[model samples]
Target: MMEGTILTGARIFDGERFFDGHALIAENGRVKAIVPEAEVFGASDVTKLDGGILAPGFIDVQVNGGGGRLLNHDPSPETFFVIARAHRKYGTTALLPTLITDTSEVTRLAVEAAIEAAKADEGVLGIHLEGPHLAPARRGAHLAELMRPMDEEDLDLLCRAAGEMPVLHVTVAAEQVTPMQVERLTKAGVIVSLGHTDCTSDEATRLFNAGARGITHLYNAMSALSHRAPGLVGAALDAGDVWGGIIADGHHADPTALRVALRAKRGPGRLFHVTDAMSLVGSEDDSFELNGRVVHREPGEVCSKLVLENGTLAGSDLDMASGVRFGVQKLELSVEESLRMASAYPAAYLGGEKERGFLKLGCLADCVHLSDDLRALRVWMAGRVR
Candidate 1:
C-alpha cells in the first residue's frame, strides 16, 4: 500500500493531450497513481483544487538570466540556481541556463557550472551552449569577438560534460558547422538547433538532413522566409519532425509569423514559447547593465543603449505564463493552445515528456497551479508546492 496526497478536480495537461481527471497521488517526488475523481483513495491527506488548473511545470530551454543576474557574466553554479528559483516563482519548474557566445574559457566554465548545478539541484536541468561556433552576422546578443570555428577538442569537452542529463542543446549556425560535426553531435544525444546563421535554403536542407531537430527562436536570429530563397525558416516549416521555440512576447517575432508557424505546424506542439530573458526578469528596478551598456525597462519593452543609441529593442522580461498570455490574448491563439505552448510543447521538444514535463502516471509529480488570469498560484518542483 502507498500513501501521500491527492490533487483532485483540476484540469490536467498530459504530454500528448489535455485530459480531465479527478486525482493524482504523489509520494517522494514521483507520481504513484492518477485516478478519476470518484475512485481516488488511499491518501491520508488531500488538496482539492476545484477551480484551478493543474498542468505540467513549465520547461524553459533558453533562459539567459533572471533575478538581475546574467548567465553570460557570472556563469557560476550559484547563478544557475538563482535563475531557476526566480523563474520557479513564475511557474517555470525546470530550465536550461543558457550562455551567449563567449570566449572558450567562459563557455567551459558555464558548462562545468551547469553540470555541477544539475547534480546538486532538481530544477537546474542543464546548459544551453548557444554560440561561440556561429556565424557573426546573426549573432543577436552574443559577443561577436568570441565567435569561432568548430573545433573537435571543444566539442568533445561539451559532450563529456553534459553526459546523460537528457537535454543538451547546441545551437550552431547551419552554414558554419560541417555535416560530419553535426552528425557526431546528434549521435551523442545533443539536440542540434539551427540559429545565428544566414544559411541558404539548400544549405539549411542539408543540415536538417544531417539531423538538426530544432530551430532556435524561429525568425529572430536566422535568415527570414524569402519568397524565392525560403532559407532556414522554409526548411523548418517544410520539415514535419522538427520542433521549434519562439519568443512570442510580441517583440522577437511578429504575431503574423507566429500565426503562420502555428498553422503550418498544425498547432502549438512544434511552436513552443521561450523567454530569452535578460537580467531584468522579475526585477522592478528599471535599469541594468549588460556587457557594459545600460538597459532600461518600460511598460512592455526592455531597451538597450548598445542595440539602439536612444531606445532599441532588447531581450524580453517575459515569463512562461506571460508568454502564454501574449500568445492567447495578443496573438489571438486559443487558451488551450496557448497553454500547451507554455507547458507540453517544450516538454516534447527536449524528449522530457515521458518523465518530467506533464501530469500523468509514472511521471515526476511536477505541476503548476494557476489562477483564472494565468498567474501562478503555486508551483510544485517535484510534488510539494513551494
Candidate 2:
C-alpha cells in the first residue's frame, strides 16, 4: 500500500477558484484530496510548504522547442524529453511538441517520436502539426516551398498518426483544407485548429461546423477581424463555442486588440496564450536555424520573439512563466484569471478538465508553487517534486 503525503498550509488555487488554509494529499502519485489545514489528520509525514500560491501546473498545447533545441531542427522524440524537462521547471506539467511545416520524412519522424514519448509517459501529451497544408498569404515563417494543398495520401497519414497517438493537433488554413478533410481528421480524434489562412467568415464557419475546435495564435497569422470583412479572426470571436490561442508577447499582438478578443470571446470558446517558443527558452543561446534559415533576436530587443535574417518573424522564445506574468502585469487581468489562463483554461481546452488540470479529488497531483511575485518557486508534477 502507498502511504499518502500531505503538503500543508499554503494558498491553493484548485483550478476553478482559490482557497486559503488548505493542504493537498497525494497517494500513489495521485491527488487524494484537498482539505482544510485543521481537517488534515495528524500525520508524521506532513510537510509544511512555505507561504505562496499553489495552483495547478500549466499545460502548454503549442511548444515548438525548448532547452536550446528546436523540435523541427532536431526532429526526434528523445529530444522531447529534453524539452519537457526544461519546461517542467517553469511550471508546465504537460505539453505538445509542435513541429512546423517540414518534409514528409521529418513529419513522420516527429509523429513516431511523439508516440514513443507518450508510451513512456514522458509528460508529452502529443504532437502538433502546424502545416504543410497552409495558406501562402498567411504562411508567416513557414517555408512556402514546403507547403502545398492537401491530398488523399496526406489525409491518410494524418488519420493514422491520430490513431496511434494520445493527441494529434493539426493546424491548417480553413480554406486550404476542404470540409471533408477537416471532418475526416476530426472523426479520427484529431484536434483541428484554424490558422495561417485568409478564409472569410463564411468559409471559416464551414470548417467550424466540420468540428474545428480552436484557432491557433488568433489575430496574428490568419485574416484580421475587420468590421466590414469579418474574416477568420472575426468568425473565431463571433463563435463563442470555439477555443482560440493568442501569443501574448507584445510584438505578436497589441494589448488593445488582445483585450477585444478576450472580452468578446464567449465561454466554452475562451482564449488562452501559447508561447510558440523556439530553442532559446531554458538556454542562453540567442540564435538558431530553422530549415536552413537563421533566426535570432534583434539588437537592443529584450523580448524572446525571434526573427529570421531576412526579417520574417520566426517562432517566439517566450516560456509558460513569462506568458503568465504578461497576463497579469501587462494585460491587466487578475492573478486568478491569469493563472486560470495558464493552467485551467488550456487544460479545459484540451478536454483534461477534471483529471489533469485541477487539484480536486482523484485529479493528478500536478501543481506549481508560486512565490508572492508569481515566479515558479517550486513545482509538483504528478505528485512528485520537480
Candidate 3:
C-alpha cells in the first residue's frame, strides 16, 4: 500500500493545456488523480495551497553551474547536487548537468561525475555534453585548445558511461561528425543535437536524415538563418520531426526572433525553452572564471559577458521559471503556450511525455506552484518537496 497526499487549489497545467482545478491525489510519488477538493476526503494529509498556478515542475535540458560552482571545475556528484539545489529553489525540478567543451580528461571526468550524480541525486536528470566535437569557428566561450575531432573512442566512452540515463544529449557540428558516427550514436540511443556549427542547410538536412533529432540552443552557436544558405537554423525550422531549444531570456535572442521561431515551429506540440545557465544562477554578483579565463558580468543581465576575455557568452544566469515569464510577458507568448515550452515540449524531446512533464494520473508527481506574478512559491519533484 502506498501513502497518499492531496494538494488542493491549483490551476493545473496538464502539459498540453490548463484547467481550473482544486485538488490532486498523489501516491507512491506519482500523480494519482486530479479532482475537486471535496472528492479527496479520505487522504491522510492535505496541503491546502492558496491562489497560484500549478504546472509540471520545470525541466531544464541544460545547466552548467549554480551557487558559485562550475560543473566544469568540480564535475563531482556533490557539485551536481549543489546545482540542483540552486535551480530547484528557482522552480526547476529536473535538469541535465551540462559540460561545455573541454579537454578529453575533463570531459571524461564530467561524464563520470554526471553518472554518479544521476545515481545519488534525485533531481539530476542526466548529462548534456556541449562538446569537444564542435566547430572551432562556432566554438563560442569554449576553449579552442580543447576542441577536437569526433572519434570512435570518444563516442564509445561517453555512450558506455551514460548507459540508459533518461537524457543523453550531445551537441556537434554536422560537418564535423561523420554520417556513420551520427547514425551509430543515434542507433545507440543517444539524442544528437546540432549546434556550434557552420553547416549549410543541405548539410543539416543530411544530418537530420542520418538521425539528429534536436538543435541545441536554436539561434546561438550556429550559423544564422540566411536567405541564400538557409543555414542550420533554416534546416531546423524545416525539420518537421526535430525539436529546437530557444533561450528566451530576451538577451541571447531577441523577443521577435523567438516569436518567429515559435510561429514556424509551433504545431500541436513543439518548441522548448532551455536555460544554458552558469555559476551566476541564484547569485546576485556576476563575475566568475572558466578554464582559467576571467569573466565579467554585463549590466542589466544575469550572465552575459562584458568582454571577450573568455571568447564566449559564458552561460546564462536565467532559470526556467523566469524563462517562462520572459517567454510570456516579454515575448508576448500565451501563458498556456509558454508553460508547455517550459515543460511538456522538453519532455516530448526526451520521449518522456507519456510519463513525466504533465499534471495527470500516472505521471511523476513533479510540479511547481507560482504566484500571480509567477514567482516560485514551492516545488515538488516526484512527490518530494524541495
The best candidate by TM-score is 2
**Model 2 ranges with Cα > 4 A deviation:** 299-302
Instruction: Rate residue 141 of model 2 by lDDT.
Output: 93
Candidate 2 residue lDDT tens string, 265-302:
87767898788888888889888888887898864222
Instruction: Check candidate 2 and list the clashing pairs.
Output: none
lDDT of 3 by residue, 1-386 (tens): 22576787778777776667668778888998877667776666788779788889888898888887788988888999988998998788888889999888888888887777888747787889999889988888887677788987887985686574766789889757987888888887788999999999999988888999899998998999978989998889878898988877767888888888888873443679899888888776558888888877776443354334634577677888888888888778888888888888898888788767898889999999998777889998777777
lDDT of 2 at 178: 92
For residue 237, give model 1's deviation from the true position in Å: 0.9
In Å, residue 207's CA in model 2 sits off its true spot by 0.2
Ten contiguous residues minimizing lDDT sum, candidate 1: 300-309
Q: Where is model 1 more than 4 Å wrong at Cα? A: 16-21, 41-43, 266-269, 301-312
Candidate 3 matches the true fold with a TM-score of: 0.95
Candidate closer to the true structure by lDDT (higher is better), 2 or 3: 2
Which structure is stronger by TM-score: 2 or 3?
2
- RMSD of model 1 against the true structure: 2.6
Give the Cα lDDT of each candidate: 0.78, 0.85, 0.82
Model 1 / residue 305 / CA error / Å: 12
Clashing residue pairs, backbone N/CA/C < 3 A, model 3: 9-22
Sort order, lDDT high to low: 2, 3, 1
